[model samples]
Target: MNITKNKFILLFLCLILLLIASFFLALSYGNAQIPLDSIADIVINHLVYGIKSNDENGALYDIIWLLRMPRIILAICVGAGLSVCGVVMQAIVKNPLADPYILGISSGASLGATAAVLLGIGSTLGENFIGISAFMGALGISFLVLFIANLGGPANSVKLLLAGMALSAICSAFSSFIVYFANNMEGIQTITYWLMGSLAGANWPLLSKLVPLILICIFLLWSQAKILNLMLLGDDTAITLGYNLQIYRQSYLLITSLMIGTIVYASGVLGFVGLLIPHLVRMLIGTDHKYLIPVSALIGASFLIVCDLCCRIILPRAELPIGLLISLIGAPTFIYMMIRKTYSFGSK
Candidate 1:
């Protein structure tokens, strides 16, 4: 037992180091390509002595602190948040294939963002009206799914899945209808880019609000590790062990919705991070939630930081949408995992 505990501790330390390395790597590379030593100097100087940049290094300072820093931080938060939510969602439904967006939240968020951009909905809600609208839509659809699932009786995994699918379809149809009739090509283009997801809009103000929320949600979910593990044993088995899982399932779903909604608001819809990271971590460390949650979070954060860096460097002048890149990578990797016969979900 001591050996196992020590192994986990070592693994965590390695992942944390990897995450820190990825963060610095991302900071060093961009369109301008700042040097690592300079990047470290600027960051440390500002953090320690409350110094802004001098006139000599003004451009580099703005590029590092103003643009890349917030974007990279947002990427880490979105990545970690999505991955942790994936862990909880899979446990909630007791399905290996489940992801954070399986419950129609993504579609709902898309619909809301679409309405905000094209139809000028929620224009009165301040500068972040689009994101606010998206959050509202995501949270609303999640509750709607819960309501639909509980129509006949207590909600179960199967019922929740079906309700989510039904609502997802409906939301997609609505979004398409709005897009088709809007007749505004510029708005359509903006919506298209938004749906594909980008970290370009990331700023310190947004990060100030989003980072804390994501970290809190991740911590709360991590604290529920034991309950999450029990969820894998099926509801009846959990009941036999003197724990009712229904309330826990609903609670987890709600928390995951909030986290994912916040992510959508920040980075638009990032696919596959949530779906991919948790499974990848589970394969490495087994299905123990205590180990699974933090490991997956760290790996996911590093994964996105690297991916976001790729997005910046892939094209000479333009950046690729992160959602498209992730999908391209995640789908093929997932297919390969499925074909690998030795790799079973939730197996030690």
Candidate 2:
């Protein structure tokens, strides 16, 4: 036990180092390449010494600071948030295939975003009305799923999963309906791109709000690691151990909903990260949520940073959507994992 714990501690340290390296590496690559030292200097000067960019270095500074930094930060937050949520959701459902969006949050957010963009449903809100609408939609559908699941009795994994699937299908249909009938081609195009997901819209002001929220959610989930471990042993077993998993499952769903809603609002719907990262971590470190959550968070953060970097450099002039890149990488990788006979959900 001590040896295993030591190994995980070492792994955690290494992952933290990897995340830091990925951050710098991502900062250096873009449309206009900035050298590593220059990137470091600019970051240190701006953050430490409180220096602002001047004429000669202003363009580079803007690229690194104003644009790339926020995008990368958002990528980290979204990736970490989704990965942690994935861990919790899978435990809640006791399903190896479960993901953060298993509760229909992504589809609901997409529906709300589609309505805002195509039909101007939330135009009266503010500059970020679309995001606001998406957040509300995600949260609303999550509660609806809970309510439906709890109709006959306490919600269970099967009931929650079924409710989520039904609501997801409904939301997707509504979003498609809105998109198809909308006369605005521009709005339609915007919706298409937004749904594909991009970090281009990331900004400091947004991150200022989102970063804290994501960190808090991740921390809260980590604090529930013991309960999550109990969740894996089946509800009856948990009940025998004096833990009622019903309330815990509902609470976890709500927490993940908020985390995912914020992610969708900031970067649209970047799928597969949530589903992929947690499993990958579990494969390496077994089913212990104490180690699983933090490791998954770091790996997810680094993975998305690299993916975002690829999006910027993949095309000569134009960038690919981060979501598209993630799917391309994640789908094939996941298939390989599925085919591997050695891999099992809770195996050490």
Candidate 2 lDDT over residue span 1-348, tens digit each: 212888988998999999999998889887888898888888898989998698878988999999999999999998899899999998988888889888898899999999999889899999888888898899999999999999999999989999999999999999988888889999988888988999999999999999999998899999998999888888888888999999999999999999998888888888899899987887788788888899999999999999999999989999999889899999999988878735455322
Cα displacement (angstroms), candidate 2, residue 10, comes to: 1.1
Q: Let me know the TM-score candidate 2 reaches against the reference structure.
A: 0.97
Candidate 1, TM-score vs. the true structure? 0.97
> What tens-digit string does per-residue lDDT give for candidate 1 at 1-348?
112667889999999999999998999997888999899889988999888899877888899999999999999999999999999988887788889889899999999999999999999998889888998999999999999998989998888988998999999999999999998999999889989999999999899999999999999999999998888878877888999887888998999999999999888988888888987876677788888899999999999999999999999999999999999999999887767634445322
- Cα RMSD (Å) per model? 1.8, 1.7
* lDDT by candidate, in order shown: 0.89, 0.89
Screening candidate 1 with a backbone cut-off below 3 angstroms (N, C-alpha, C), the clashing residue pairs are: none
